[model samples]
Target chain A: MSSVHFDQVYKRYENGHEAMRHVTFQVNRGEFVFITGHSGAGKSTLLKLIMLMERPTRGQIFVDGKNLKSIGSRAMPYFRRSIGVVFQDHQLIPDRTVFDNIALPLIISGYPDKDIGRRVRAALDKVGLLKKENYYPIALSGGEQQRVGIARAVINKPTLLLADEPTGNLDPELSNEIMELFMRFNRAGVTVLIASHDRSLVQALNYRTLQLEHGSLIEEEVVA
Target chain B: MKMASPLDEKAAPSPLPTERHKSFGRGVRNMDVVWRDKINAYLRAHRYELVRSLRTLLSAPFSSVITILVIAIAIFLPIALVIIVNNIQLLGGNWDGRPKMTVYLQLDASENAILTAKQTVLALPGVESVNYIPADQALEEFKRHSGFVDILYELDENPLPAVLVVVPDKIGLSNDGSKVLLRQIETLAIVDSVQYDLGWVHRLNSFMALANRFIVVVTLLFSVGAILVVGNTVRLGIENRRREIIVGKLVGATHSFVRRPFLYLGVWYGLGGGLVAWLMAELGLFALSGPMVELAALYQANFQLQGFGLINSALMLVCSGLLGWLGAWLTVAHHLDEIEPL
Candidate 1:
């Protein structure tokens, strides 16, 4: 079954701006997919729609086989608990330490304290930052901050992971490292969908790519 | 195509650890164990949120203290007013200011004639009781109270006259009947003069009633002001944590979860304000007790200052906390919706 399926979805803002137009796509469970587009090519809008942050103006979208239209605002949190999201700026709360940042999702999910500590440590180990649990986000380097963001997203062990320009601020080397980290999670039976404007990076990884232009899905490419 | 919502499907995989644990042995699971875990997790979440919110307030101690003081002062005004009005009413109640007429008699009147006059006054309509004061006893009491012993001794004759203190019935005090009684006493052959001042008692009763109404209005106005004070402070708190709220929402935090800390802040502010206001009012009352006793002594009235009783104090603290909770709930409900992850 498809983890995320968008069928002829359209998103138009209040001021006559259409962010997504007839965007139809599907990402099966355990698949790694990349959304490629220019800055205003509806990349972020697609991710927002999937996260239920914004509703489509037309057509139905499905996540984990449940139609998006059926989910109300009250049910948004419950739905989102099944999915993970990472942002370009790494959205780590400045006041919280790295461990606290990752443990937030678990805390929100009502995990036992002992379980939270053990899972947070495991996530930290998975991100190769186990020793920096006490460090605040401000003390981390750009790449390390992004890694912490990834750790937080995956800590809940969501079936689907969404990232919007996750490597947008990093150098090429750091960006590739972040991509490899996504590949590892994708291999672990978690479906990964990342949106990035980097053409060379998409070409190097050669995953299933969905290209968006003028708020429309123009092409789908699978290299290798 | 029709599709089933994963939420209702038993076949769907549960992402939350708690759900997954419950699904492990869905039919065979021990209900008691599940309930215990649920309660423990619930308690842990509350304990964690409580500490988290308290730290947020303590992180800015100066601002928190200032906000609390503003709330305290706002609530203190009405509380102090209520206490003052209460004391005034207590004094009035104790005085029981029924109408009374003091009749001074001629010094040369015979003792038998004075007794006959007292019996006549007691028999008059609406006259409750009449007590006679002999000339020698009156002179001795005057010397003791007037602080003029030498002057009294220098006079060759005792100039003070015998007196009769007459108390009127409640019905007579309520209307003009008492004045007619006074006039009747004035015409007595043995009486020199009759004095009665019922107007002052009437004025004081009316004034006390007005004070009670005034306190009710003032207390209501100040309670609203206190709630708003807490509301605005919580609103500002929500603004400062706007980014955190947005991030929390993005990560699947429920509205109540995001609202928990701000609500706690409001309760803390209200409770702190209540405690400080209570202290301020009690201390002020304490300081005034000495002066109040002296003032009561001047009037020759025995009275003691009454405080906001134990129940009243407890009621105030609970009310302040609830107001804080209500303010925070309102602010959080309004502001949390405005902040969306998008």
Candidate 2:
């Protein structure tokens, strides 16, 4: 069964700007896929559609075997809990410590207090920032902040992980390290989908790739 | 990039918990455990949010104190008014609920005439009892209580007339019974005139009824003012945490989850205000109690100022807390929906 399925999805904004046009694709369960295009190529729009942050003008989206169209606003939060999303801006609360930032998802999910500490520590360890858990986001370096975002996104062990330009602000070395983190999580049986325009980085890690141009799915590369 | 493999046996445990129930009895038992865990988690979440909101309020002591003080002043006015009205009612109650009529005998009324008048008053309907004051006893009693003992005795003759105090029964005082009794007493030949002070009592009672309504009006107006104060404060709070709210929503937080802390903040403000209002009221009553006792003593009456008892104090706190909750709810319901991740 496919983890994400999009059939002839079309998205047009209120001002008549077309964001996604007749986009059709499927990412199978446990698949590691990349969606790459230039800026304004509907990369973010496609990801938003899957997250139900924006509804498609004409299409049906099914995430984890449930039709998103049938899910009302009241059910949106529960639906989002099964999927993890990372932003380019990191979106960390400045007043909170790294530990609190990552433990947010667990708290929202109402995880037991005893389990929260253990899970947060394990997530921080996975991102190699266990010692800096007490530091606020303002004190962290750019790359360190991005890793905190990744840790927070995966803290709940979501079945599907989505990252939008996760390394947009990092140097090439740090970008490669971030990419490696995604690869490790993908190998751990969690499906990973990254929307990035970093061509060389995408080429170095050969895997299934979906290329969008002019809001349409123009090319799809399948890995043997 | 060199790190331990996720598949290594020593790696951190996966976040997911595997399921194991297969038999019917085991499933039911596991369901019970799950329910217990859920309840615990729910309680823990509320406890954490409550503490966190308190910390947030303390972080900005100046603004919070100002907000709470505004609410307290709003609460204090009505409470003070109520106390004033209550004391007035108590002072008036000293006069008694039913009106009394005084029948004045002629200055030269003979002992036989005075006695006949007293007996006639007793025969009238609604005349509960009658006490006759002879002219000689009246003169002496007046000299003792008039505070002009020497001057009252210097008068050429006793100008004061003998008096009969008429108290009406409960049934006679109802409706026009007292009026009829007054007219009958005035018809006696030996009685010079009859005086009924029910007019003064009626005026006092109407004033009390008017003041009672004023308390309700003042309470309602101040309550709205207090609610708006809290609502505006919470509105600013929402603005300050706009980014946090967006991030929380992005991470799968429900609207209620985002709203919890703000609601608690409002409650804290209300409770603090209520506490301050109670203190202000108690202190005002305390400061006034000294003078009040002295004043009541001057009139030879025993009266004590009443303060809000335990039940009323608790009610004030609970009421203010609910007001705070309501204010936060209105602000959050309006503003939180306007905010969404772009």
Candidate 3:
């Protein structure tokens, strides 16, 4: 079954600016896809739509066969657990340690202490930040901070991963490093969807790519 | 760069698995096990959040102290007034548990008139018994005590009138009953005047009623003040941790989870304030104890300032805590929604 299905989704803000227009797409389970668009191309808004943070003005969204519109505010948190999200600004809580930041999702889902420790450590290792668990995000470099963000996004072992500009601050080398990490999780049966405009990396990686322009999907290409 | 395999392939345990999620429960996971784990998880989160919230307050000692001190003072004032009112009630009670009425007859009343008056008084309702002191006998007793026996012999006749000390029945000792009986006895033709100290009882009764109303109003005002004090404090706390709350909500924290720590912070505030209020009550009682003892000595009575009982202290803590919780809940419910991550 498809993990994400958007059917004729249209999103318009109250200010009359259209963020998405009649967009339709489907992501198969365990697929790695990148949403590439220039700034204001509605890439972030698309991720928000899938996350149900912003509702589409018209259209339906289904995540893992469950209709998002039917989910109430109380159920929104639980629904979000099936998906992981990383942000462009690396929204890691500055006051907390790297370990605590990653442990947040697990803690929200009420994971046992032992399970939290193992999973947090494994996720840190997955992002190659295992030794920096005790350090604060401020002490880490831009690449390292985004890695912490990634570690947190997947700590709960979500089936679907959604990242918006996950490497917007990183250099080409670190961007590739982050993209490769998403590939690893995808290979492990976790569907990954990253919204980034780094064309060199998007063209270089072997995944389905959806390119958006002027609030509409203009290109659908599969990289070899 | 080439894609690598996942770091660890071992699946992490699923905390809540659906009944038909057979693959997750393959070996050791079962319905009963899952239920137990969920319950355990809930308890652990509750415990951790409770302690963590308390630590948050303790970490900021000066501000916490001021907040708690304000709450304590609010609680203490009403309770102190309550204590003062209670002591006054006790003092008023000792004035006269059962006062008597005195009837003075005309000095020139004949023996037959005295006899008729005695018989008439005995027949009245609520008149338990009456003692008749004739004029000459009253003058003799007064002369012995007044050291005026020689002076009394110089007078033409005894100036003292026949006095009838009337004791009322138990029913007559109550508020309105005493007044009714006094009126009935005063209308007698032979009686010159009727006197009873029930006036003091009536005044004391009204004073007590007024005091009770004052206490209720005062307690209500102070309780609301305490709640607002706690509410404002929690509001500041929510503002300070606004970022943390946003992150928590973004990462899938339920509203309750975001609210738990603030609720606990309010509880700690209540706890400290309640205990401090109790402390202030004891201290206030202690400070006044010396004067109380001296006053009681002058009255030849043994009166001690009543300290708070154990149950009262416990109730104070619980009530203050509840107010604190309510205050936190109000603020959190009001502010947490505005904190959703964009």
Candidate 4:
């Protein structure tokens, strides 16, 4: 059973540049998938389309069976709460502490205070930074900051998780560690899709990978 | 397992892949619990949002004070005028002119009869006092006021008649006591006629009424100006927090969520202004109270300065809150659309 569906998706910027052309794919429920391509290969654009950050210019997207076109602006928040996103820059609110950053999604979704505290601590525990709850993002290393972003994304227990080059600024070992964290979530039945152009990190995972070139999907490969 | 084409799937994913079905008996109760919990959680979030907004306002003490002081001074101008006008009306009532009867005596009348008449007039019921003005003094007063001293000096004898001005102890309940007194004084044997000009009295009354109307109109205009002042302040506040609003929108916050903080900031401004206006009005009245009482005593009038009544005070507070909310809403409606999560 698929969790996300993109059919012949195309994205064109206001300046007439088409970031995505005839792109199509699916991430089944409980499936772990990687989207790998060179810079400007439409990887981030695809993740954005899935997150509803950017609407498709000429295509349909179905997340959890609801067509993206049908979701109005007023209902977008409720829809977004069901899917978590982790950005490459670890776009955490700078002034907020680690605990507050992880608790933001749940707060937006209106979780109770006790429930928020429990869930936030649990998420921090998962990211292996339970003791850093009181610390701000600025005080953490790049890898630790990305971990907070990942923890925030999964804090809501969303059905689908999407990350856009989440480890782009991290070292090789830290990149693998972040990939390991994503696999741990995927193994627990959360659908995961990661967009990255890092060649080496994509190799050891042996997950189903979709490769894009320019603005089109050039190949789909699965390790034997 | 061999890999399949990524685009092979033609159907949309199922929204509920792991569905849980239960008996119908628990449906209503389950729904009740779900709705109650949902409402409770949202209420909790609103609590946090409100506190967060308040903290933001308090964090920037200098700018917040400047905004609030601007609003306060705007509100103070109109309120102070309103209170002053109200007290003046009270003083006007106390100084209102009473009807007076002027009795003209025959030129050839006896001095004894005139003296008896003066005594008789003073003894009359509801007659406060009687002043006997001989013809010579009356001529001098007329000459002084008529601005025609040359023509008045040409008179051989004092042509102005001797007059007795009668002040009533109190005006009648029906306001016709002065007229009845006039009729009684006219029957006096030595009196030639009784003269009382009511035109000047009516003019005085209308003047007071017109002054009140003008003050009320001015107060209303200033009130509207206060609203615009608050609106502009809130607009500037929104501009400063533009980035915070964009970030809030990006994180799946609704328009109201993004606007909540600004609305709170505006309320703080309004409340601060209202309180200052109230205090300024009270202090102004206090400063003037001693002098006002002394001035009213000169005319034997019991006058007191009155601040806003409960109803007026409540209206002022309610109006301030609404003005703030309206200003915030108008600004947010226009600016919120320009910012998008993208």
Q: Model 1 over residues B216-287: C-alpha lDDT tens digits?
A: 888788778878888999999888888788888888886667877887888998999999999999999899
For candidate 4, what is the DockQ-based docking class?
A: acceptable
Instruction: Classify candidate 2 by CAPRI docking class.
Output: acceptable
Total clashes in model 1, counting residue pairs 3 or more apart in sequence or in different chains: 0
Q: What is the interface RMSD of each candidate, in Å?
A: 4.6, 6.0, 4.0, 7.3
At residue B270, candidate 1 shows an lDDT of: 90
Q: After superposition, how far is residue A80 of candidate 1 from its true place, in Å?
A: 1.7
Better of 3 and 4 by lDDT: 3
Candidate number that wins on TM-score, 2 or 3: 2
The local distance difference test score of model 3 is 0.83
Could you tell me how far off, in angstroms, the CA of residue B216 lies in candidate 4 after the best superposition? 6.5
- lDDT (0-100) at residue A108 of candidate 3? 74
Clashes of 4: 0
Considering only N, C-alpha and C atoms within 3 Å, which residue pairs clash in candidate 2? none
Off-target runs (Cα >4 Å) in candidate 4 are B1-26, B94-243
User: CA shift at A143, candidate 2, in angstroms?
Assistant: 1.1
Model 1 — TM-score against the truth? 0.82
The collision pairs in model 4 are: none
Candidate 3 displacement at residue A122 in angstroms: 2.2
lDDT tens per residue, model 1, A42-154 = 99999999999899999889987889898887667767877889888898989889999999888877787788899999999998999999999999999999999999999
DockQ of each: 0.42, 0.44, 0.42, 0.29
Q: How well does candidate 3 match the true structure, expressed as C-alpha RMSD?
A: 7.7
Candidate 3 Cα errors over 4 Å, as ranges: B1-35, B96-122, B126-180, B187-193
Candidate 3 residue-wise lDDT at A218: 91
The TM-score each candidate achieves on chain A is 0.98, 0.98, 0.97, 0.98
Best by DockQ: 2
List, residue by residue over B247-316, the lDDT tens digit for candidate 3. 8878777677788898899888888888899898998889999999998776556778777678887887
